[model samples]
Target: MEKMTLSSKTREAQSPTEKWMRYLGFPGGILLFLLILFLPPGAGLSASAQSGAACFALALVWWVTEPFPTYVTSLVLMFLLLVTRTSNAKAIMDVLGMEVIWLNLLAFILSSMLVKTRLAKRMALWLVVRFGHKATWALLAFLVLQLVLAPLIPATAARCVMTLPLMIVVATIYGSTEATPNAFGKNLMLLNLACISVLSSITMTGSSANLIAVGLIQNMGGHRVYYMDWMRVGAPVAILTMVLMWILGQKLLFRMKPGEQVPQVEGGLDLVRRQYEAMGPLGFQEKKAIAIFGLVLFLWMTDIFHMRWFGVEISAPFAALLGAVIVLFPRWGILSWAEADIPWHLLIFSAGAYAGGLALDDTGAAEWGVRMLFGGMNLKGVPFGLTYTVVVSVMMYSHLLTTSKTVRTLIMIPIIISLAKALGWNPLSLALPAALCIDWVVGLPISGKPNVVLFSTNQFTVSDNFKYGMMTCTIGVLILVLSGATWFHWLGITPSFWAVAP
Candidate 1:
């Protein structure tokens, strides 16, 4: 009995390092748990700040771990925030109407119909079959398709979920596994999928974070990132990145044998075509969805210019809500309420994220954080362009931590802008594109919701994700820096980049 008791005690007393290693990958959850256990007294924050920090940690843990349904976790966090005064009840209530969240919900419904109708499947299979049997061509087709689909779809998860199953099917057909082909093909396919996904933010409607970035840019820096403006600057970068991906992806990730025959996928395109055909002449629901989506796009693109009738200006959020309502017109016999199948969990997550942002604003956390950060790393007498370049570069590379890219961007833009201005720089020149592309460096599945959806399939392992992620991040940093320098120069703000201190 004594020996048994001693053994039990020994087992219970494991080192902190050992426990930390077990949970290292889930930093968001671990960080939150630590904060809850040890709230610093007089941390120079209001009660709201403390409550926000706790809720932020809880929401983040749930988001990263996903032990409960994501929406449920989000709601719990939002509830905690409201009850604890982390956010005012009114502001917390307002999080529901956040344009990006509603847009994603509507987009998900349309995506569901596309899935049910097998339209997305048919499209992917068509690309695979048309590309002959080469792996490179297959990847290229997927990349091009994602780029084209991003502007229209508006939600990265919808895009990824639509395409990922098809990619898995293709990978399975090729017999690519972690152990097979020296882990080459598996890594390549996963990496390519991840790399292309970043392009989702190139358009205003592609990802929620991009929308948030647009709003923050306007609010913080007085610069509005219009839809066309984003496309104009972003399209070029996306095109160049895709080209580089083809080259590096093949060389670094996977090397296909020259004579390796691509396996024949049985009933591949035929199955997809047949399934789509089964939908049998588009229903009124699909037509209505098409019309609503088309109208939203038309209004957003043109509404910026024309607002004459009753002075009725159409905001993006309002337009999305309008489309969402039209989706469920009982009289029109369009989509049913049950058929919408919205991911309410994501909306909950949005509420928690927005609550955190509100907490920062309410408690002056953003301002306080900016001051401390500047005090610690004060770059003296640096050229404004050089300082801007360094700050933007760091911000872009810091996305390996969180799952919600929207939350990450929202957190960074406010702090970064505050810091940039204190350092004697025009914050917009440094902050605008940084706000836009910070989430683009998401190299892991947990870096964004799109990534999680893509990772759900057993196509890639965590190691596979990290190996490819590191390379992609390296490439991203270089591209962002060079592009920023070039774009600034083109805009007549020639940058004199300071050499990094050893």
Candidate 2:
């Protein structure tokens, strides 16, 4: 058939390296599973625990390499876990019903309300019209846009898609195109790329991965992470990380030339203004969308105060459900079930990862692995500062290896919690700080969905992305380590300096 021929041509068009990596992914996963399954059961795990570890190792390999779609890989992992007797079918199914998964589902439905009503697009245009005259302010405008949209739109790719056309217009205004790229385009696209992910750390509802990390703390670490508790720690850290990234990125990483410092096209600003004017004024849909989302956000922000005022608390999922109900309520609602734009594949992917993570916890595999690994590292006498730094650094940089933030959280948080247990330290000390770093997936084009969406413009090279991302990540690590010592200690998240763990 013609479709088969087109598929063959597409495969032929790939680079040799891409072809090899893709072809090798399946065998690579199998090899890892077999290798780990047969590893000597030392003092760490029982036979079932070893099997659980093997399943996890295989999932990690396939997730990173992605032999199939990530969700399909997750499905395979779930079946393998049940087949290998690592977990039961009922428990695996139960993860899909968890509050975290419900939150993600409802978040996307609410996100669709914004997209359908064009509210997200409207906000982006207004900001650009207000502050997009100069190159410097234009970059900052998009950064601020990301911060505003992160909490509202749980999907980063959706946010990137909404703003991508705007990025192109701004890039063209500065005389850069796919054919004629310049530092201005580089800075504009890269800043949006980083901000879209980095700013997600600011709020607990910003990304599904943040919710996953928080859920793990309650389910695995046995402590609830209130929204404000997360906000108190993550807000300052994520904001500082974004501020430093913007400064260092514009000044040192991608310095603009004199000619490229200002808008090169005379009528480009008018074009953006006209685009905003084309929509005329805010319609009934936009206002209703705003009102519904406003209620959702107010409930989320006031969760800690809800018990005192209302006699009971509105959980994150229920608050989102309240808005979703309005968005889907017959003729009054904006979108129908088919138009909500929920990504069932991604939800399934999270469910699989969640199932795998909980399976490891239930079977004692995560603890056994952490003990065997950290016991050999001799972390007992090390200062808490050193351990915190190492854990945070590992979580921050681990995004470069794996493409999925959910995978990183599911695999790493449980291990970090177990490590905290083994080291006689508070789980939140290591887990919460590391969870804040989960959304900083800005290194490579493949690092995140948002990165891929922006990189499609071909405005910036991989090297440019690498340069800015590495610099920003380094700055981020230093900022976090500094926070761990001072701000975090003051907030009682991490212990004071000069204190060694027993």
Candidate 3:
């Protein structure tokens, strides 16, 4: 098998045509920006707003085409905003320290502790050993393991890396070698990737993209989505989707042989046991990391309780930071600064993106764009149920076009929020559901990091993934739409469709 780097797997091979497109992307973006900037001032947009609009156009082109690294584009965005006087240096710098950025940083630290202590691997092995006697049970074991680690790990790529080897071992145990694939191997890899993507949407800290969505919503003056709040709305959809995928895999996609129904592998359970035992006993450091993470989760979930009794409200970032501090405190700490796998590039990208968003909002560019795009649609008169359904569906299937979940969130959430304000509807009603769909990056091998990792296994082809992915993506969209009409209504996210005057 050929060994490819992570970057090589995630990035597609560029054709000569694509190379030309990349070359033209930057100049085209600048031209578009200049055109927008010099256009006649209509729709009540001021000169500064026009400049912001121009900056956004150029940023969008750079973001979508990758004339440079996305993080570089982000830095360029901040610089452009400053040069144009669309935003001041203090404002641009201030966005770098926003609560969202801190939450992401602390989450990275916590995740680093998990990776360093090897607790994540231990938990996965333990689960597979206990419940993986049957093919169906084995699949469910992986799904449940991912769900358990989603909040704690935060990074989808890291979790995928931790589980990929185990998945390969399981496939080999079932006699499904990459050279000779079978129903079980195909289903196992595809379903594992799908479940990881879906589970990421269930918690705010589940993925960086989720946090980006939440930050964008908060920037738009909507109510903050806390850990509990996201779980309340996203949990049902996530769980239902997982169950649906399991049914699809077992019944329709992968047909198990009669002998394969039971754990027929000569030493399937033994493999897991040996791996589990290799770690030896749980070390003191692992125990300390576990305790600190538990305390953080408790504080995050019970913020309201602490606020009422102690008159001190602890934000999610602060709680996470507190846990991270305890983990790095010299005497009791488990992780060292050198061991931290923090993606500094992502943080830099996020800072610039946040600054761009802030400039758009401040210069009224977001509002202007919203009016220009949706003002004539009379979307305000459409029933909330129908509108919500369409928006969620669009967001879910958008993965077919682009591979970057963070970029998708960056582009979609702000537009949805602006649309909500234009239509006189609660921004959360539209933005939350759309943001929740940010993690639905399962339609292609390039859709997300997990997909890339799983695809490299050679257990399945592109066609296999597309067939299963399209089916699952469609089902996921339907679940979100149905929930928006009923479940979300009960939670005060989706309004009564018929109650409003058309």
Candidate 4:
């Protein structure tokens, strides 16, 4: 028995397949780099551009395959770009200091403050205590909590971590254990996952991928998507999707039992109330954090107004930095430097990805690739509506193939921009809707961190998640298509297919 146990442990420790998978990235990247190096430079692109394209291909392979840490691959990408003389060291490093990077950094600091101050938990507890009398309303309360927290906590995984314990508690109170989940438990867990991923699109700062998308859009010479612009388009879809999910959960998907209409969770409301009271009234630090965030949000929304009156625009990153500074001030600040949960790995990866994007632009590699892929397709004459639907649909459903939202953004946005240019349509029209689809990553357990986290609760099975996720994902795509045809058309985002010649 002892020997059998040892053998089992050894087998579980590291499968040969897993070992080879991790090592594949290095050789795969090398082969791609060599292939691009040896390929003839296409017309309208320089030899240096060809090298840059090769570096990007190497980065893409490593990023997707995960032979190394994603950030490590980013470092490799920067090193290769410099060694290959595709770009200089200074140029590559400067990408780290881009405005988008700072925006993400400040956003992280702000999110950390929320976590540290316990203000997010307080708000959630208050909502649940106030409205959680019934199972359906309790589920709605949690959804509302997520909606409120999404903008403040940009990282979906962080928000999920914060709420997971509470979700487990609620499930227990309702007599929905991991071994025996009621409809209410399954609904609550799945809905939490859906809300975390879907609502991430409703604000520009709601997720790093959204900001990355904005940066790439600007790289492609499209209009920058401001916080207000994203809110205008994404808010309606988010709200509609949440409402639809609520209805589906109650009626179509997970029908609540009659007893579930009024949960008999002994002391569940009291537990939440006590938790809220234990916070002992809002602290000075929480008040200060809220004030700083409010001011920052105001400045972000009224940026154009500032430019008009003061003849100087306050960019989003500047506003965020200002807020972060106040939140970290000596006297009234909410968080210490050590407490800031900054994901330096993601920052480094983003910097390298941005640099790669710049190389693609400078070397004309983006355009060259576009021409090579679409040049022979005669797609210039395709109708705008059909193209819009196809692009949005593909972007929405593509989440099943990969898990990293950043990777999806890095790969898809540039290609979409290039395709839009090739087809002579508004790049924003195609790219923005596609960008919104970045956070719709709840279709599989590996689709996103939140999905993974929620699945671990064991209240819902994989089949449960797949059913709920696929249905909602399909609905989400329809919402995008409908908005493009109606709301986007009214906003002048989608021009008439016949307006311009091919």
Candidate 5:
């Protein structure tokens, strides 16, 4: 559940957007599926491939619209896959056994260690006390908090749960509340939401979708993507994007008023200080959480050196399992099995999404779709730079339509990779960059779980979020596009934009 969505109530058919979606989502899914199902086969698309595409369309419609609970839609997807013979029951079952699912389970266990131990809260409060003196510094502290927590906790929701109260507390102290708010509160909440998403893009374990993308790249694209390989490219781009967002949000988007710039309530800073003091000295549990998480992170980061030093490789799932093992160990561990927060539904949902993706690949649906898409664009003589811009841009902005990162990865990555291969370009050059952009689900309050949780405080409006999201989205696209031609080209992740020809 790394990059686990935080808010379960985000799409609960209450809001105006979701209300319409509720009415239209199911019928829309069925119509799309029927239309695709009845399409006259041609252009190298097989019958099985056509069926797979239809199933994907239905599942995607439901996922985006939330006509059913996302998990319920996933269940229906699995059933449709089997009934339509898009993927066999055995292949669907094997989706549960993928390392991506295992990593997700273990990552949540690791996250529970941080949440239960209160280590994550302690770190967050300490940072704010150290940096929350001013509104600007306080916002930056939360930004740093998400960055620090992204790798350690693995689950984005868990990190949000840990820091959410702290965010509310700091926002309140700075004179922002649910009923009444200010620029400071708006910036704080929105900035934290954006950072949580973009920062997760840097590490493979930061979210399940990232891991799923890696698995797809390895299995379907035939190119292995290692943890460091993602971090090596993603860390620079994501971190820089977050910093820019931090600056642009406060300076350009949501400038603070003089009165709102400082703590509004009497002794506001003192309240934060008291909370930090209430944490008392670091206890045994906090130290152990730190130690356990430290060991896991070390393994995740130093993966390339493992084959040389240990004569064996510790994959991402195994590294997490090792840490989770220590966390659940009877004597050495801090939490009981009951204490670990594992959401089996979310896990199942992830499996179904991934299974649908693999079925598309197995049936050649993804390839056929990519070929049709590229054929219409007539990319025959297009330079890689221009084509690269279009590819990453679509992946970056696709969040507006598809709310689930898992669904986005399942739908987009295979097509992007297949498109790159069709053009004789390295798949990673297109696929990995597209994967990194998948986590920028910041445009709408309904875009992600954390956005919903933060929006509950009423600190930022839909318009406020939309404006900030567009700015960050545009910035992310520009950064990826520029980096593709320079930094990535220099690093050989993207060899040359000019090398690809038709």
Candidate 6:
């Protein structure tokens, strides 16, 4: 009777807190949607009131959750624009033909091939065997390995899936304390990988965003982004940020014991050696897959220089198509089509976001939002730029609001574009920095895929990641703002929407 009474009291006591937590869950998203609905028009929306309403209604739905697949959503949006006379069907569909989307799709297909061929694992094993001895050094090796792979594997989740299991194995070897050593090491490994991958993705071919950013620039400002041009601007930033992360991590977060041997790794090189030994020699199919991947990557990267000789622009989509062909070709038969379980939903999700952006453009909703946020802003002085700086800075803080950074980007980008136009500023200046800042999600274990993967080991807790991650993010933001200011100036661009009178 006493036991039953105690159970009843426990259940009763927990009910209110559960209710409170559930209510608090999606409040920010709800609030933002409400604000958009209720807010007065700023950009010529009164003139195109009906179109604006359609845009906002679509955005509200997009923001809430997907009732249909994203590509389906995008197609529906295109249909709506045509029916509403906001835009011709051709104009709505034009954006969907974006090369960036093709690049992402191809990138996914190639990544799939890599995993299927066990190439990613083979490469990782080769690196880990060489550096898996020292605990701290092993961490650095893992970071570098992932850096090399980031360009090829565009999806952070896919990257995490590839690396996380190996990291767990290494962690087990280190016998690092979950409270301090294991917790700190694991968090640092995942955060650095994810963050650095993000920084590297600024190059046009690196991530879908780079492509999207370029496309936006062309559509808005009549500028085209070339592959090498992106490299020139983004490469320096990637290198600098990578160095900062490594140096800071080594100095503060990850400490090495003096004169310690590399932790003894279990099933280490010995396992890899035995596995390789059993294979005896590379199979003909394996060789073909490798040759195909190498050729595809090389041809794609160097196509700009050898376009005439190559006789074609080797786009990411074409490369992926070739890769898929190689994989399922009867003679090669490395993977049957049935074994290749591609995540069709992700592709649709990406398409949906693309469509959503199209809808915003057609209805002039994006322009309206831009006007309200930055209309009449004078960025002639440091203070003016500083005012804009607040949004850029807060974006780093906003990572706390979502578990998925891509989701955050999808929602944030349109509003950011609107704000930039209103402020009379360059959208890329604000949007790129803000998009990059979303990577500073080191604050919680649940913050990113890599974080959650490591956290599932039950070695680290939310409080621990919060304590260290907050410090890292704070420092990272300061660096971003300072670097961004210098970069913008060097690019011969100014943030002000209108040119200051000479």
For residues 1-502, could you state the per-residue lDDT of candidate 1 as single tens digits? 0000001011121347534533562566657745763676545556666666666666655544444444565577778777876677888788777655565566555455444444444444555567735666777777777777666655455455445545644554445532233233454456546655667657766666777878887888777667877766666666676677667767767565553335334564455345446647756645655576576666554554547753777765566566667656677635577766555544555555555555655665544453444456767576554666566556655664343465567777887777666665565666666765654744654455555444434345444566666666666656766876677557643344553322
lDDT of 3 by residue, 1-502 (tens): 1111112122331468657657898899989989998899876788877787788678767665557765687789889888888998999999878765676567667766776776765765665577766778888888887888777656566566546656765665566655666788887898889888888888887777889888998889468888888988888888798889987887887787866655445565786678779889998877987798788877765665777877997767777788888888886688788766555665666677667766766776655554454445566677787777767876787665444577667767887788778777889998998888888888765466576557656576555677788888888888888888888889898888554423
The residue-by-residue lDDT of candidate 5 on 1-502, one tens digit each, is 0122233333345469778977898999999999999989877988888888888779877776767766687789899999988889999899889765676577668766876877765665566578867778878877887888787755555455446656765666677765566788889888888988888898987888999999999988899988898998899988998899888888998888877776665566686678769889989888998898888778776767899999998876788888988999999898899888676765667777767777777887765564455457755567888889888887887776545688778878888888888877888889999999878889976577566546545566556788899899999999999999998898888867766574
Candidates ranked, most accurate by lDDT first: 5, 2, 4, 3, 1, 6
Instruction: Please list the residue runs of candidate 6 whose C-alpha ends up more than 4 Å from where it truly belongs after superposition.
Output: 1-35, 42-109, 134-139, 142-236, 246-281, 367-373, 376-477, 480-502
Which scores higher on TM-score, 5 or 6?
A: 5
Lowest summed-lDDT stretch of 10 residues in model 3? 1-10
Per-model RMSD to reference: 9.7, 7.9, 8.8, 9.7, 7.5, 10.6
How do all the candidates rank in terms of TM-score, highest first?
5, 2, 1, 3, 4, 6
The TM-score between candidate 6 and the true structure equals: 0.55
Instruction: Kindly provide the TM-score of model 4 when superposed on the true structure, using C-alpha atoms.
Output: 0.57
Better of 1 and 6 by TM-score: 1
TM-score for all models, in order of appearance: 0.62, 0.64, 0.59, 0.57, 0.66, 0.55
lDDT by residue (tens digit), candidate 4, 403-476: 46777788788888988888888799899988998899877654676665565455665456778888888888
In candidate 5, position 172 carries an lDDT of 64
Q: Write the per-residue lDDT of candidate 6 for residues 225-294, one digit (tens) a residue.
A: 5776666655555556655666665566544454223443456457644554564566665576678777
Scanning candidate 4 in windows of ten residues, the lowest lDDT window is 1-10
lDDT computed for candidate 2:
0.76
Each model's C-alpha lDDT?
0.57, 0.76, 0.73, 0.74, 0.77, 0.52
Candidate 3 backbone clash number: 0
Q: How accurate is candidate 5 locally (lDDT)?
A: 0.77
Q: Name the weakest run of 10 consecutive residues (lDDT summed) in model 6.
A: 1-10
Clashing pairs in 4: none
